[model samples]
Target: MQFDRKGLSDEDLLRFYLAILKPRMIEEKMLVLLRQGRISKWFSGIGQEAISVGAALALQPDEWVMPLHRNLGIFTTRGMPLHKLFQQWQGQKEGYSKGRERSFHFGSGEHHICGMISHLGPQLSIADGVALAHKLRREDKVSLSFTGDGGTSEGDFHEALNVSAVWDLPVIFIIENNGYGLSTPVSEQYRCESLVQRAKGYGMEGVCIDGNNLLTVYDTIKGVREYCIREQKPYLIECMTFRMRGHEEASGTKYVPPELFVQWAEKDPVKKFEEWLLLEGVLTYSHMEQVKASMKAEIESELVRAELGGPIVPVTTEELEDVYAPVPEVGTDKDIETVRQFSTSRPIRFIDAIKEGLKSGMEEHSNLVLMGQDIADYGGAFKITEGFVELFGKERVRNTPLCESAILGAALGLSLEGFKSMVEMQFADFVSVGLNQIVNNLAKIHYRWGQHADVVVRLPTGAGVGAGPFHSQSNEAWFVHTPGLKIVYPSTPEDAKGLLLASLADPNPVLFFEHKALYRSISGEVPEAYYTIPIGKARIVQEGSDLSIITYGAAVHWAKEYADQHPELSIDIVDLRSLLPLDYDAIRASVTRTGKVIVLHEDTLTGGIGGEISAWIGEHCFELLDAPVLRCASLDTPVPFNLELEKNFLAKSRLATTVDRLLRY
Candidate 1:
């Protein structure tokens, strides 16, 4: 095939060849290290270097790149130091992820590149978010994201494409169609004639190109990037490339047909590019050989330095650190205590208090953004965000499609780009659709990379009158099991506003559960001014000595009402606002004084958070317990649709009976 420079200068063409050579040499060295037992594993993109190098050369320095695991060419092209890459592979503390991540799992914030995660397609939405933020700020930058042909089967891929197309985000979604996803071939993965064809359905332009040709790959990517940035819209490119090696060094080509391996090996991108450069007289054969020799020497020197750096020292005491971002100072001039003096004299509904807090948060932080289904013009399902569109404008108070996983994934990307996002799930039960991204990506980001996602997912949770299982669910127990997540369940308007404001200021990912049942039923004096209730602290709603009822969310209100009716019991109510970071100090003090305890929650009995609280109290306050710790939770059955059955299931009468039995025992 004839070489097509496409108006590129000789220097640019030479740089592309160098870009391909650097990663090729580095990856080859990594494989040697793997065999030497110096590195744990290596996932080489041996014949696919042109795709990453082409795309990296096309992107502007300020534009962001979200490369997949095999895109080592991106790291070298983006100016990542050879020593840092070797240190990461050697598990040294000088690595980008502080030795917590391996291989290409660590990203460089300084280079505008996000590290790769094993779960393939979620990063598309994250890239979309980065592009969206740039557009909102009227910046001219774009984002380039990569995925494999196998990743197109993931639901996140579809969601990301649809949303990016609808929003006209400036992003280029590149699919490196390397013929296999691990061991499964493209035929088994999907029925489409070509993955690029799916882009047409998303209302975006699509193209298929010869990924083996360095000049063609570079020209195609540069043109697509320019078009995306100029039109402020997304584009899809399917690079038909092949990986000459297996998925990883440990995985051999036994599953792949020998004929297919031979076919792809003959078209190695590095060899093809070098031959093209030689034919075009862009460089002499000796000059090309010199470049290869220099790259090999550099890789070897870095490997030596990495080996001498020693393994990272594990600090057991520091294991629990950096789980959450430190809470920012409450407000411009007012702290929590000072703001408390200015509390609103009149009572307001719980929903209004949340809205007020959001308004205050947005006004305080210019980077704060709100995105959810029907949250813009429709004001959301319960009208909690009513009039937000006009107040904040569509750019800040954006409405999103019903793709929960992509919505949260985008929010995570926005958070990484210095935006604090408040993402509302229309119904907390619907969070199941996006649970994979939340559990695997958002929750583990901090622990894995020392990065904090300043994002709040507002979950309208719990059961009340008629809403059945899907609409009403107390899912806090599910999140309490997850580390690196802060969970807040407020029972009153005052606490609701305070806690919501606090969550916004927190640097970690927070699950803010606003009980759907208490939106209107609960009313209290919520401060008009911004104030924060410290996380991990419990409030003593009512102080007493005889018995203690420990609860949170809507159950706190039920417990308070039960205590009010029976004055003889003299029960103390401990409202736990935070679930993950349990208020053990307050619980210890309350249990020590009362000598009897009852744990209450609206979730089912078997795996409810009540059991965790009960077990902790049993182990820590065993001697202080006047009787065995008692639990009052709904029966372990799906919430029924019939109002009568629902009432019977979570009846206050049942809770009263349980409390009465505990006191008598």
Candidate 2:
């Protein structure tokens, strides 16, 4: 496809030039603020405003866009207030993203702009997912993501592009080739002549545009966007712009050669567009001055408004604010209605239930996709998704390489593209490898910018059957401490199926814990249709007034077994499917009913769920408890390969043992 520059009118060029003046001024004023100690740093877009503004104008309003730190021009051109932009640069609470993000981080949920991450090209994967979502919803919305020329070196960029190319996703990846990365020149960054040419490696289209020419850049992006929507293909657009300023305020331009600086400064995009507008008679010199004056006055007003609000006071609670939309209404009595009776079906085994849940959910929602290592034809390591490829086809159920970090990093891009993805870590123990991508990048995106990322991560956790420490382990505690994530560990197949479905539907990132021990250990009947068990709710498995035992995952089954054996002792069992949002209400109710409580988990004693649960119970339900709230967990040691040693470290919570312990207490 080619840009029809002749079709463009003077009016289009005039408006485009006017849109860039504000962002350009914002960049200049921010640099001055940095020097005046009003801001800490600034990444100027003096010579590159045209490319940023032009690309943003080419996309539809609801289409997704992920911008790099230097692309503030794009957001400003798309209606981001400069005062809000200044507030972000000054680290104020009234900043563009409500103090959640730093300078260069701005997004609008209403416009469908995904959040930004500092990591190079990581948002590229998110853009892919966002586009995938649009495709699933049968919407024409596309996703556009930007990165610096240096970002192409990151694995995330390549991974996202490869996946998008293979899937024919509606995405456009833009590389703002601004001559240098910090002090490092482009020649040192890559061997390629232009960044766009790298798209050939992923079997995608590529184009280069004169970044200084606003009309040329805008027309090229418009053509490429049309191709993306109509052909459903990803494209790499390389805009050859120049960085007239240093990488940041702290860095002087001393490293750059004087000759190159003068050359780019002479071709300044803002100036070129302004002069072109005057020559075309679309705008007068006085009209240009009026626009600038209006922008300055508006920016000054926003600055005053931003100063009215200061830095945010952190949330006191460990858990984030609740985000539960579309709560399921209580079903009418099954006996009274035939439809209600049909909906309330019998429970199924955790393993079978999970498979059926995924199948049903995938069929019901086209935007829902399953991806991870060995998930497609290999059916996942534990066969939890044994026949997913056959059911959803290769497009939806995909297998990936063994790199856990890449799997997660790529999923971030796909989520940004608008696809809700369920990514498996193969084994819960291996999730540590991708912890940076999950905790640092994905989990923090929403907190960084009030943006939503709907992605589900499934990890097979718990120890038993001699998988050894490397494979057999529950790592929920590691993530529980991390904010901006929801954790769910379900014991039964029914709860597993329900929780997995619910997690998929959640608007933010969810970590779904599946126990390897329960994969095929038990069997039960389940409904053939779709259903969801809420993320933060708890289920009372067995009720008693004597004592309360709180547990989740394999420990829940063990707790149940112990309760069954000790018929003489009265005990209450509560399975906490959601970990981040501990069903404290149910726990408190159980604690109030029985004045004694024991929290248990398969993980080590230190920093485990038991410790947190025990502490919470002590703080909130302390007066109601007759006995001290206690916790039982495995000994603090690596999970040994020997069966006897492993069993010795396991919490002794069998029915008889638990009953005897409570009686002694």
Among the numbered candidates, top lDDT falls to 1
Error of 1 at 306 (Å): 1.3
Q: Give the per-residue lDDT of model 1 (tens digit) for 94-181.
A: 8877778888887777888887789888899999889988998888888989999999999999999999998999989999999999
Reference-based TM-score, model 1: 0.98
Candidate 2, residues 499-577, lDDT tens digits: the string is 7877787777899988877878876555555667777899898889888888888888788877787787788999988
RMSD of 2: 4.4
Give the number of the best model, judged by TM-score.
Answer: 1
Query: All candidates: CA RMSD in angstroms?
Result: 1.5, 4.4
